[model samples]
Target: MELGLVGRTNAGKTALFNLITGSTAEVAPYPFTTREALRGRAEVPDPRIDAIADIQDIPRRVRAQVQVVDIPGLAAGAGQGEGLGGKALGELRQMDALIHVVRSFANNEVAHPEDAINPLGDAEAIDIELLLADREQIERRLEKVRKSAKSGDATAKGEQGLLELLVTEIDQGNPLRIVGDAEALALGIGMGLLTAKPVLYVINSDDPGEPLPELVAYATSRDAHVSQLAVGTELELAQLSPEDAAELAQEMELGDVRGADAMVRAAYELLDLVTFFTGSGPPEARAWPIQRGLSADKAAGKIHSDMERGFIRAEVVAWDALVAAGSFSKARESAQVRMEGKDYIVQEGDVMQIRFAV
Candidate 1:
């Protein structure tokens, strides 16, 4: 899954990116410090994979990984080519989900672009910018589609109708995500509209100990999730060793190292993704990501096309069952191991071994 860290200038976007991905991208208290999208991988924690590996006496080498992209901050006229606005907004469109970092922190040395610290207002402004960008994209596409429809193209005519519907929805202050699934998918892929992707608002505050009610309500009203984090503190924590970071966190009574994990997990949820495991022996046990309800065959395809081509039944056992039985053979004997067909829906925490015939 790919997640984009986005917000306005001086919203602690880069700092949050550094905290989550351990990236050293240049961070400043100003706009456009990050001109290009910074890419990094974050290891997702899955204790179930570890448990399965231990039961099978396998060395655990791999954990699940999520790709994170930190795009440059967007501005008021981002879609129309403002300071890094067009480029950043374009990059943001490709992300599977967005982590919108709203500044709730106050520091005189580093000024907000709007010259005040109101996370709710910042979120609303960002949402409006995204909405406007989508509106423009839809309007332009509708014109092209209309032209194509005039040529008697059935597909273009159909898509044009959908775009028109979408435009009406957007104009009514509704995002494309709330549109019909067919129209949503059509618009989502064709337009790459930023608001089409799921978004979680991250409230960045100076005071690590308190929750911001305004930020929470703003996100809630939009049906989005909100997470509170002190970006500066998280950046400081990111620089320390895990042990030292834990010590510092305990000392500060910050309670949980600033929600980096929660942020990633929420991103996963927003994308409707889940993790499944392959391999049972040490270091060989690895977790792979799949959208919810993905079939066994599709999961195999994620591993390799050849695996899908060979397409045999999968030996499936729940993680907890494997741990209880202590081994694959024991699990089989206990009837905990079941052979699943290619079409079987892969579940989270499922340990699968594919059998294929060449």
Candidate 2:
């Protein structure tokens, strides 16, 4: 899965991106610090991987990773092709979801483009830009579809009707997400509408304990998730050793859990993904993330095309059950493992061993 980080200038997007991906991306106090989009992968932390690896004595353990992209700060009029707006918004269209980094921290050194600290207003500004961009994209598509509809194309006529309704909705200051028709929403997503993608609002605040009711309500209204992070503090903690960071975090009254981890997990939930494991023993144990209702063969395809092609059946067991049994053979002997056909819907925490023929 891929997540794109977007928000107004100097919202600490690069700082959060660096902390999550362990990248050395330059973070400055000024706007447009990130000139272009930077891509990196973040390992999704799961205790089950460690449990399975320890129990199986696996030599190499690979955790599931989510792709993250840090796009440059979105200035006002970006949808109108303002500075870096065209390129940045274009980059966001390719992401699986969006992480809107809203600035709530009052830093004297860091400059807010608007010269004021209003989280709700800042979020609304960026959101409007996205809406504008989506509106323009839809209009351009509607032009072509209208031409086809005039030629008596039934599918084009239907699509034209949907686009017209959506255009009206966008004009009324509503996102495409509010549209109830599954077909219309699917069409919007297929067209890469910016507002159609899932979004998580990450509030970059110094006093994360203090709740911003306005922003929270806004997110709730939009059907999006909200997470607060002390980006500056987290970046400082990131510079320290794990032990030292843990001590500092405890001292600061923050729990040992990293904010980035919590946020990434939240992003995973936003995408409605489930994780499955792939190692019983040997050189490697790995975790894979897939959509919630992915079937056995499709999950196999996530691992390897060859596995999906030759898929016969999957030997599956819960991660905890496998750990309790200590080995795959032991789990099988105890009847904790089950044979699932290709159409079997894989479950979360499922440890699957694809039994296939070349």
Candidate 3:
């Protein structure tokens, strides 16, 4: 899965990216600090993997990961190819979702294009740019589709109708996300419309507290998720030793869950993903992120094509069950493991061992 961090310049997107990816990409107090898209992997931290490894005495454990891209900040007229806006929007097209970093704090050293701390307004600005980009794209495609439809191509006719509806929606200030028609939404997503993608709004607050009600309402109206983080504090925490960071975080009443971890978890949920495990291993114990409701055989394909091609059953047990039983053998003896067929739907935290022939 891929996610892109997008917002106006100096919204602390680079700082948040550093906190989440542990990469020291240069962060300056100016717009467009990130001139090019910076890519990194964020390991989805699951304690269940650790527990499985501990109980099974596995030598290595690998957590599932998400690919994150930090695109340069966008400005007004970005849709018309303003500074770095063209490149930024191009990168956003490749993302499965967007993590919008709206500036909610006042920083004298940093400069905001609007020169104000209105998170809601900042979010709206980004949304409008995305809408403009999509509108241009759709209009261009619609012109060709209109010509094709005139030739009596049924598929082209259908697409032409949908595109016209989408144009109407966009012109009326309605994002494609709120099109209210399944076919239209799916078509928009298929066309890679920016407003059609899932969004997670991250409020970069100086004193992180309850997110502003205006921003929350905006997200709710658009069927999106919203979260807040003190990016400055989290970046500082990231610089400290783990032990010292924990102490200071405790002192700051930030609670046990780190901002990066929470953001990653929310990203997974936004993508409708579930994590499964392969627990019986001397070489490795690993967590696998898969789309929810994926069948057993397809999930095995994630590990290796040979496993899925062999076509066999999977011995599945819950992570906690395997840990409580002390070992896979013990778990089998206790009837904690089930022989699941290839059609079985994989569940979250399921520790699966495929029994297949070569």
Candidate 4:
């Protein structure tokens, strides 16, 4: 899963990225500092994988990695090629989900691009910008489709009609994500509409301890997820040793300093993704991310195409069940391990063994 961090200038986007990825990306209190997208892998937290690995005596390794891209901050005229706007918007197009970091903190030293700290207003502004970008994209594509429609091509006419409806819906302030069924909506997939992607709002607070109700309400209204974190504090936490960080967190009354975990989990959920594990061998149990509701065969493909092609049956065990049974043999004896067919839905935290002909 790839998640992009985006927001207006000085909205703590890079700070959040650094916090999550432990990356040393140059985060300054200004716009356009991160000119290129910074890529890093984040390990997903799963205790079952740890327990299984421990029982199997596997060496620890990072499991369930998600790629995080910290793109340059976007501005008002970004869609029109202003102030790295084109590059930023282009980066956003590649992301599976967006983490829109809104500035909820008030700091006179670090000036907000809009000269205010209203997260709701900032989120709305960003939405409008995305909508405008999508509108322009639709219009441009519609021009070509219109010519094809004039040719009396049946497929072209059908596609043109869909585009017209999409335009109408978008003009009515509806995002393309909320439009219709994925099959019907696949007609406009090539258009690269900005509003088509799922988004999660992150309220960047100056005080690491405080929560913003306004931002929470805004996210709820849109049915979008919200995360709150003091980017600067997280950055500091990232610089410390794990033990030191825990001690500091205790001092600050921060429950668990796994802000990165929350951020990554939210990103995964926003993208409708789930994780499955492979191997009971040492060197850490491996975890792979797949789209939710994927079939056993498809989940095997995520590991290796060879596995998919040679797939016979999958020996699956739920994480908790396996942990409770204490061993794979025990789990199998207790009927916790079940043989799943190719079409079986892959559940999150499932430990799977592919029985292949080859």
Q: What lDDT score belongs to each candidate, Candidate 1 first? A: 0.80, 0.90, 0.89, 0.79
Q: Where's the lowest-lDDT run of ten residues in candidate 4?
A: 183-192
Q: How many clashes does each candidate structure show, in the order listed?
A: 6, 0, 0, 2
State the local distance difference test value for candidate 3. Answer: 0.89
Least lDDT summed over 10 consecutive residues: which range in candidate 1? Answer: 181-190
Q: Which stretches of candidate 3 lie over 4 Å from their true place?
A: 54-59, 281-283, 320-327
Which residue pairs of candidate 3 clash?
none
Clashing pairs in 1: 58-281, 58-282, 59-282, 59-283, 60-283, 61-283
Q: Model 3, range 313-345, lDDT digits (tens) per residue? A: 999999999999999899999999999999999
Which tens-of-lDDT digit does each residue in 217-278 have in candidate 4?
76765567888777777778778899998898888887785566776777777767778887
Write down the RMSD of candidate 4 (Cα, Å): 2.5
Clash pairs for candidate 4: 58-282, 59-283
Cα distance off (Å), candidate 4, residue 301: 4.3
Encode model 2's per-residue lDDT on 1-358: one tens digit a residue: 6899999989999999998889999999876889978999888878888899898889888988889999988888888777789998899889889999999999889898878999999999999999999998999999999999999999999999999988998899888887888888899989888898999999998864644888889998887889898988998998998989989888998877667787888887777788999998887899998988999999999999999999999999999999999998999999999999999999999999999888
Q: What is the lDDT of residue 226 in candidate 1?
A: 81
Q: Tell me the TM-score of each prediction against the true structure.
A: 0.90, 0.93, 0.93, 0.90
What is candidate 1's lDDT per residue for 1-358, written digit by digit as tens? Answer: 6889888888988887777777788988656688788998877766677777776778755877788898887788875666678788888888888889888888888877888877778887888888888888888888888998999999999888787787787788776766666755566656678777788888888676545776676676566788877789878887899999999989888876456776667766777786888865554888888988999988988998888989889999888888898988888899998999999999988988898876
Predicted structure 1, TM vs. truth = 0.90
